[model samples]
Target chain A: MFVWIILIPILIQYTLTSVVPMLISFFLTFTDWNLVGTWNNVGLDNWKRLFSDRAVWDSLKVSVIYALYSVIPTVVIGLLLALAVNTRKKGTAFFKSAWFFPVITSVVVVASIWKWMFTAEADGIINQVLGLFGIEPQFFFGTRLALITVALLGIYQSVGTAMVYYYAGLKGIDTNLHEAAKVDGCTGAQVFFHITLPLLRPTMAYVLITLTSGALKVFDSVYTLYNQTGGPQNAANTLVMHVYRTGFFNMQMGYASTIAYLLFAIIMIISVIQYRITNRDVE
Target chain B: MKKRILNFFFYVICILLCVIFLFPFVVMLFGSLDGETKYAVTLTSWFPTQFSLKQYQSVLSVGGRMSRWVLNSVIISVIPTITGVFLDALLGYIFAKKRFPGRQLIFWYFMAAIMVPYQATIVSNYLLYSWLGWINTYWAFLIPGMWTVLYMFMMRQNIAAIPDALLEAARIDGAGEWRTFLQIVLPVSKPGLSTVAIFSFMNNWNNFMGPLIFTTSEKMYNLVVGLSSLNQQSASFNMQMTAGVITFIPMFLVYMAFQKYFVDGITVGSVKG
Candidate 1:
């Protein structure tokens, strides 16, 4: 009785907030209604429109590219950083904290700082570095480089989180395996590839799935960096950004829900694929 | 000799990566200190040649909006953190320890909620909140986010580790569920509670989208949204850096203070669970 009394309210709140909204979102996909207007049953119209939507496809392409750019580097570099810091040598704590600092920092601040650094002017820090190599000033956010630049910012912020996860994964590995491999005349690289890499599969699955989903839903950095316009020519507009623009800015609720559901489906499919590939040996 | 050489190279590489990671923060800090004259010049140095708090002074001055945003951030973050910790702890305790009808059904229902991406539900959430007259109000952030399934899951895992004997003993002493929760469970689960609190606080403090969408008035903006708006307004780099630094300081301090909890939370969240 007491348990029910306590749990009932939270469950009610949860249903109202999460479950109801989700059901409503599903229902919205079958109907068309701007916030202030009457609902019209559109049935499969939004879904059909999704197929021919050039902007939707463009944003999907941008999101996939962003995810590829961000997720791969985040995983690889994060693992390297984890390996370095996992040496457990003296002074490694400082390095761990230093590397993990950005994970705690807000995305808006990170975008702001990186946007400043990637300023297109010759005097911008990155452009200045380029100039030292006798390269011309590059327009980072102004050109096709915009998506990559935003993706790099995503990588910068998330690499710390990935590093922490990989570090934990590294810590979980049995040191005896490494020593045994070493005694068998296995090289460091060989031990890592043959033993450590395989053992870290579960962690890889977790990291890959989470990072991929996060990357696909990438919005905060791009929104901030591009000033909510999704960059010049919508170059950096991610799927979530497209949803936000459609639903909020354009006031097309039904179409926005359709795009959002499609994104959800994509994430679910990709996460399952990643889980299967990474966990092939585990089961 | 080969091992020593390899170790030396590893250190070199690690040091270089650390510099790469830390450079932007250094830039943000030093950039915030530059006076108007020095900021207008071509970037010749990473460090400010002339150091001044002119930007910070302007950003945080009485006439500025940064302070309001800071307050909004605090209200938005602190309320959710406190409420989330308490409610999640209670609910986690219920799910973990209590024997009740429909427990598995309710728990799985909450678990299933996690599969639905927040983006998918956001459109309806917007419509629902607006219908409830919550737009431009703190209620939008506070209500929907007061308790999360993820935090509840964490708390459930944490609270489950409490030996059943201990809880049984508490009940044997004639303590009610609420008393047992307030007295025994919470004290034993301090580490878990703190971990949840820190994460909750961090997520709320740094949340950009909720505040951005919910709050139309400039005064209602949290620091993250406020800073983004300032950037969108094409504020000077120095000014924007100052805002960035201001926004970052609280989380930095929190991380510094609870550094252990942060690492433990990450490992516990990923590696173990």
Candidate 2:
């Protein structure tokens, strides 16, 4: 009875998070409700309109572009960092923790720093760096280039996570195998391809899934740096951002729920596809 | 001799990599010290010529209603972290050691929660909170985050690694499941518990969007949202960086104090069960 008492409170807390919101969302999806007014039953109109919304499509495209820009660089650079640091004999912990710093820093802080870096004036870091080579200061945030820059920042922030995972993976391998390969006259390069790359597949698989999910949910930096407009040309407006704009900013609650569900469906489908591909490859 | 040279090369590479990763943080630290926006505008100035605490003061002194927001954040974050640690351990105990009907199904349901993005349900969550009179209350933040499905799963993995004989002996000695959990399972899984605690605390501390949508008033905002709004409302760079500095301090201090734990917490899956 005492255990049950302890259990009940905890269960209530957990279930509230999942159950209450879920029940509310189910009802809200079929209604014509904005936050300010009384809700009315709208049937499937919100769902239907969601299918053809131009902003939704545009944002979806931006999401895909944003995901691609962040995910690819994150994996590659993260792997290289892991591989580089794995070779280091001393200060590995320091380097590893250094890389991991951005992972913990608030998104707001990172966004602010990046905004300053992307400043349009000649004093901006990128502009100043380019000025030495005589290139004019480019308007980064006001163009499609701004989206890519924001995406780059996202990659920089998250690649550490991937690196840590890969580093852990590298540590799990048998040192004897590397030693044996070296004795067989195989060059470091040759051994890495034949041994290290293949052994790192499990870590790679985890990285792929995580980075993909993270990419799909891109929001904070873009929202902060771009002033919630999704950057110049709406290039950084991801599906998550679209959901936020519709739900909160625009106060179109029902429509936003519909959009959220759609994004959920899209992510599920993509995850399923990736899972099948990876499972086949692993087998 | 060859190994020594290789080690030297490795250290140099590691140092360079550290610099690359730490550059932005270095910049941020310096940027927050600028006395004027003009000084900050000069991006190439690696060091701040004029250092001042003026920004930090302004952020903290948004003065009247801002302190309430900080208090709200503290309550919201603390309640969830403490409850999540206890509940996650409880559920994890049941799943890890308990032989019960339909356990796998229950476990998978919890796992599935992780894949379902908050973006999907946040709209409804907002409505639910308002309807229940939870909006603008700490309950809105505390309730939604308590489940921590991922943490439960992690604890299960860690707990499973423990010897079953220890738990069985406790059970045989007339200890009930609950006592067994507190005595044997909980103590044995300290590292795992620590991992969960750190993560939950950090997430709750850093969360912005959850509080943003649920809390209707400025007084209900978390530190992240408070700092974000402060940044937006501040007219000058000095004020904004000060806010950034104040916001950065607590978490930074936490990280520095619990450096080893933080490192292990992050690398949990790789380092241990």
Candidate 3:
């Protein structure tokens, strides 16, 4: 009875904030409503259109690439960085906090900073650097480079959290394992690959799933960096942005819901599979 | 000797990496003063070409609306964060210490809800907020995001670490539940509370999406939304970076001061999330 008293407020809030909204979003997927119209049944038309829609298909492709590009490098580099800083030595704290700064920063702040750096002009910081190597200025926001540049920003922001998680995972590995491996005359590299790598599997799975999900739903960077529009010719457009533009900007709530549901399905399927694999029963 | 050499190599790389990580911030800091200093970056150096507070002054001016945005960000972030800390800790206490009928079921429901991504809420939330006339109001942000499932999980885990005997003893002393929670549970759980508070503040202060969708007026816009959209009004990178620095300062100071909680939070958070 007492527990219910404590849970009541949050429960009511969650129901209104999350549960009801999600069900409404799901229902909106089937309707023919735009913002101004009364939503009636659209039958399977939206689903059929979603299947054949070229822009949605393209955004999906972009999202996948963005996820892979950001997640893979962040994991690999972050793990390596974590290992490097896993020491209990002086100044480790400073280094840890330094890298972790970006993780706490608002995406808009970081995007704003990076936008100035990657400006398409010849005088832009990055282009100026490239100029020293005898290369012409590159238009980072152009079709050729917009998505990749965005991915780099995403990767930069994520690496810190991944490193922190990996560091914790590394610290949790029993020192005795290293001692035993050393007694067996293993090299440092050998011990890491043989012992530390296997122990960090759970951390890797968590980081990968989060990084992938974050990448899939990425909107702030794209929205901010390119100024509400995706990028030149929609090259940097993502599924989330598509949904936002369709629903809010274009006021096509039903169509936006359809895209959102598709995204939700993709994310759910991936997460379910990940959960099944990662949560194998010890029983 | 070989071990010494390897250690040297590691530290060198780590230092270089830290420098690379901080380079962008350095640019922002110096670039912020660029307006009055009449300086921009050169390959020769990334330092302030000249020093001036003109950019910061302009950013702080009423016309910039940067100060108002900062105040708005504070209200939006701080109120929710403070409220969330209490609510999150309370939920954590109940879920962790109390075992009543349907407790596990309720806990699992929240756990499942955590898996639903933010994108799932955007369309309906927008429509819902619009219909509620919550667009352009802080209520949209507070209502949905006032308390987070992530913080609840963190608090639950933290409080659960305290042995039941602590609570049992408090009860045996004839202490009321509120008294026990306030004097005993809260003191012991300061670290958890701080962790939740820091994360809550960070997320709220930097939150762009909720404000972007919910509020259209300049007065209600938080720093992230207002700061990012500054290019629409002015193309000056110096002034913009100055505004960015203004936004970054509070979070940075809080982080430095409360570094312990952050380290503790990550270690425990890894196991659950």
What local distance difference test score does each model get? Answer: 0.86, 0.76, 0.83
Candidate 2, residues A43-90, lDDT tens digits: the string is 999888987899998888888888888888898988988887787745
Residue runs of model 2 more than 4 Å from their true location after superposition: A1-12, A270-283, B1-17, B35-40, B44-46, B61-69, B174-176, B257-273
For residues A1-283, could you state the per-residue lDDT of candidate 3 as single tens digits? 6667768877888888888888888888788788886888988788889999999999888888889888999999989878877876778878888889888777877888787677777887888889999999999989999999999999889899899889877887899999999999999889989998988888888788767877898999999888898788998889998889888888888888889987888888877866664556221
In angstroms, the error of model 1 at B140 is: 0.7
Model 1 lDDT at residue A229 = 77
- Kindly report which residue pairs in candidate 1 clash with one another: none
Q: Could you report the DockQ of all the candidates, in the order they appear?
A: 0.62, 0.49, 0.56
The sequence of per-residue lDDT tens digits that candidate 3 reaches over residues B1-273 is: 998998898789889989878888988888886634423444444466578888877779876678889888988999999889988888888988886888888888887776787876788998888888998888888888778888888888788898889888999999998988888988999978988888888888888888888788888888888887785565577877888898899989998899777766665444433
What candidate 1 gets wrong by more than 4 Å, as runs, is: A270-283, B1-4, B37-46, B268-273
RMSD over all Cα atoms, model 2: 3.1
> For residue B265, what is the lDDT in candidate 3?
66
Ten residues in a row with the worst lDDT in model 2 chain B? B264-273
Per-residue lDDT for B40-93 in model 1, tens only? 323476677789988887788885789889899999999999999998898898
Q: Measured by TM-score, how close is model 3 to the native structure?
A: 0.93
Candidate 2 lDDT over B1-273, as tens digits, reads: 998898787778778767767766777777677765643455557467798766555555756555666677678777888888888888887788777666786677567666677778888887777879998887777677775888887888788888988888988999986788888888988887877877887888878778767776787787777767765664455555555555566677777666666645655443221
| lDDT value, residue B152 of candidate 2 | 87
